[model samples]
Target: MTTRPRTPSRTPSRRALLRAMAALPVAALVLGEAPGLLGTALAAAPPSGSATRYTIVPFLNSDDGTVNVYQSDDATDFRLVQSSAYTPPSNRIRDASVFKHTDGYYYLTYTTHTWQDVSTTIGFARSSDRVGWTFLYDYTVPIANLSRAWAPEWFVDSDGSVNVIVSCSTTNDEWIFTPYVLKAANSALTAWSSPVALSGIGANHIDTFIVRIGSTYHAFTKNETAKYIEYATASSLTGPYTITRTGDWAGWGSYREGPALVQLDNGGWRIFFDGYGDGNYYYSDSYDTFATWSAPTALPGISGTARHFTVVKETVTGGVSITKNATRSLRSVNYTTRYWEEQSALLNLPVVTSSSATADKQAATFTVVAGLADANGYSFRDAAGNYLRHYNYRGRFDANDGTSTFAKDATFVARTGTASGAVRFESYNYPGYYLRHYNYQLRLERSDGTDLFRQDSSFVPATAWA
Candidate 1:
């Protein structure tokens, strides 16, 4: 005879009750439509710009015994993208993390049990498109003394290697959780390296999320003992990390957990987490550094019942494109050592070999503003909001303050790169000629119908806004 599932003796917290209520029609009411109706109502329209932003949440369905997918364009508003149950062998999924790798596949990793249980395994899945996912493998950490695993998050390194970090507890002391790192053999999730403890032996850490700032890897984690969010940084992914900062910012309530971070379209960073036992997600922004944060505010447009969701900026139409509306430092294909510099007070080009000689004078940050037709073209803008215009019949390129007057002249068709991750900008007014670098300067020149022109016109993605 089949036995009924046992309910643990521990009292359910307010957040736990909210999570249960989230499996009901609350999301439908917040979205103002039936959850099942979303599949047909929201067709896959072309994204506004070259890239699209998405927030992914995996919620446990109380009715179906499966994990449901909720997605949002703006973090505030959400829709049930996948009403179909995502069921693994363990029949539960929580703390979901999704990553789109350089190999052009989406990978999702999650814990296989509810919050109270001792989970020994984590589930993995892969998808060509984010909508449909296929189960890949379940990873069981090789630690003989380990008792539980929770909140697994994976990152794809610059070298195309995949690494997963999870909160794990040992059999000796099951109450305290520490972070562990596991390296995958490949994108297919075929094999994994033995788990290595990321935190010190007795340190209690959970809900870890890793992000790369320049060459440094910063791991933001929930300190179980301190009851606050703390960040640590390391030179490499596998690290002896140094705790850089700790403590919740002013106005954040006593209880905060599950830290998720996303870089905004305007060169700022926002950190999100559940706060105040209300089940609503609160957010804080850091304009300069992660050390200091603004007053916590309830993120608008999200369900008050959601928890442990992740937001990632993705390219919907274009293949691996840059984030739109953000300032970026563009480097030249021909002059690999030089960058497209805004030299002098005027809008003339002078390639700079070193960004440090006159750092402010080397302020070459250009924002990729959208064009008239969403898919047709784009315009580049300076930090002061001046439009970079191709004037005099594609004869020269300069930043013009004329706004919409030069918008048509400033717009250029964005061509996909011949290489997988490269992109080219071609003039709209002049078809053959593209924005290219020559003699350490910017100019519009004819392609001459060769790979060299494509190479000269091509550029690697901007590292960060100068």
Candidate 2:
């Protein structure tokens, strides 16, 4: 060890799950970890009059060579949207983290080369839609004798500035990694200010993810020597940080790295990490911020597959070209003045001659997203991110139970309406059942092959009320 007073190095053991453990998911479950761990789930019903918000996880697959996109209404259960959604023309897509920029673009920052390469650069790609990506550029760290630059994660500051926290080392064979900060010099995010070394997160650490709550900055980083993630705090973004929790702190054990945290709408936080030594992915929850955590649980379907990826909780509206990004109101074909509405969680046809009142408008609007069971079909999501699903064949607005049954119950295949310029929805699971309203109440009933059923089932997508 040098008395250089600085320089962070490698967690030799953590390399076990680095690119070595990277990989793949769409199934969601409550945030449960190792049995007996406390799990926090969404409220049975979310507060009404909200917009559609989703948690998106973009990750690097171990055997594959691309970034995969998975989405969730709740942070616990994830639904796979795209496999190999985006790939840079060259270089390995490791430690890929995604963030939506202020300019209406989804941006990705990742380690450009595989672990074997001595690299000074982190790569970036941009997409107007999360599905299609165009390579932006590779940013070279200005460090002399830069041995490795890895896990460039976006930390958009409270002040709206964009910065990437990347760990760097001077020795290639010996990855002496410490987290460094690079501020975006341009709105394009292609250019950056010179890297600033993070104080106290000294050598032998990697994959540092930081989040700001109120005024304090909490840093969760891998302590290479201990092979466990440690928590640190500082007043400034660049810190002479204080390591508050070390061994067994937060109950997240040794041989863990790639820490990423996402805040839940329920006022809780979930931290995800790679248990590389065991080739598993795990997550823990903290209701009182990072002070306490639930036991680490294997991410259902995703635990063994995904490595070192970040999950972003974002609220989107009326901007992106993806039809799902925009919320729409379904107008009944038979009742021209009426639209679909949710009243006390029940789906009903309500008369709304105009989009004049906010209450009336929100009840009639739904966010349309790819079907949870079959992406080819469509699912209708309510303001609180719940789905317009059928329960016992009765139309009801319910939260995604993170079950295939719920996905199927919620999904509907669109068919040409009996009337021109309208559409009828055929239930995805019960093929014969269509979303036809009876007694002004929405329900999944089999078409009686009557004109009444056709008109009742058919609806036209109109402007969003909210």
Candidate 3:
């Protein structure tokens, strides 16, 4: 059995490292757009919701022949989330990638192999929630002469088609590794199309990540021989991509691999790759069209040894107020349901139903305004911009146009709903009382306190003001 080196000696000087990188025939292809065109193309757009970045790192346990799953909220800090032993036809799992689909499913793909044994099979699994995963099938590349498969990364197109790019060796005798593309037959990924080589003959490529920025598709891959992250761009997903850029930013001598790219919230891009020589992850950022990058910086807070991994953003939407409270009630345009008053001797409160509005309590029209407290929180405003406030002490809610001050009472936290594009609101001050639908009417009441509130409390996106 051939044992892979756990760590390589990091004794090379900075001067020697730079000299090694400079010796390579690095090419730079600059496809510059007009300043106005670039601005319009790369303009930052608000995400559907508050996005959370999630990363999956694999910890290969040779002793137990198991791979432990470590996850991170921020890319730096990681914690063990799951661990499973290797089963038959597979010895261990490594170089895992996690991809979240629009259908609310996360698919995990990893390289399956015995100890030092090369194989063409890649393990696959799917999870509704990120926690519990169900093993699907061993996705064997249809290449008849393939020797080994490594690092598999999945990309879902805008049209919902699923494609996976994997690095594999052609034969068992040679270490030449190249990337191959495979398209999933269906969203479930039960079957796949025949594998096609991404790179030309004699060109070594590994750890590939495909990212679409504006109208162009960019593929970032590690040149195994040169040990640097190189990039290629094409107008289409599956294409004859042009080699645009190539260089080792870390200048760590040819020990870096597994390049991953993520678009930051600031409309910039960050590239993360493993510094295998130093046994650490390093990152660099680009703000100006990926032309140049900041110096590679070492990431902190990572505990265990993580090999190839991938990061994805979790889409979360915020909440918005539909209507206000006053002499006028809030009515749904699609339904006869109107926010009406439940007149009682003890307490008169607002409820949404098919009941007709009275003269004393007419339907109230509200402007769904942005939140004053936070971007995720929303304020229910009257036409005049008066917010609806919830009294935390007494649980009394009212739409008061009198006060100019925007407090917690006027703000509600928006959480994504179970249904697609739906959102639920929770009182910012009184977290217990969620703005939910009760008795088929809109009411501020304590949630069943389940994992999520009912569908009635959920509201889909209506028209937004210009």
lDDT per residue for candidate 1 within 11-123, as digits (tens), equals 34323443464355623000101221101112121234443345475543232135556654333334567764356654566777776655666667887766556678888
Order of candidates by lDDT, top first? 2, 1, 3
Error of 1 at 13 (Å): 5.3
lDDT of 3 by residue, 1-466 (tens): 1111111133332223434543655310011122211011221222334533344645342322344565432233345676552232445666677766546677778777642455788988767756666777886787767877878887655455678888777653335577788887875678899887764322577788887766777788877667777778777776677877766543434667777766533345766777766656666666676777666666543422555667654433342233322223333322334342323211123434334344323223345555555444566654444456544222233545443333555666565454665556655543334565445445565444244344545555433211
Clash number for model 1?
2
Q: Is 2 or 3 the stronger prediction by TM-score?
A: 2
The better-scoring model by lDDT among 1 and 3 is: 1
Question: Which candidate, 1 or 3, has the higher TM-score?
Answer: 1
Q: Please give the clash total of every predicted structure, in order.
A: 2, 20, 9
The C-alpha lDDT values of all candidates are 0.59, 0.71, 0.54
Model 1 steric clash pairs? 76-300, 76-301
* Candidate 1 residue runs with Cα over 4 Å from true position: 1-51, 61-65, 199-202, 318-466
TM-score on alpha carbons, each prediction: 0.58, 0.61, 0.56
Q: Output candidate 2 Cα RMSD.
A: 15.0
The lDDT of model 3 is: 0.54
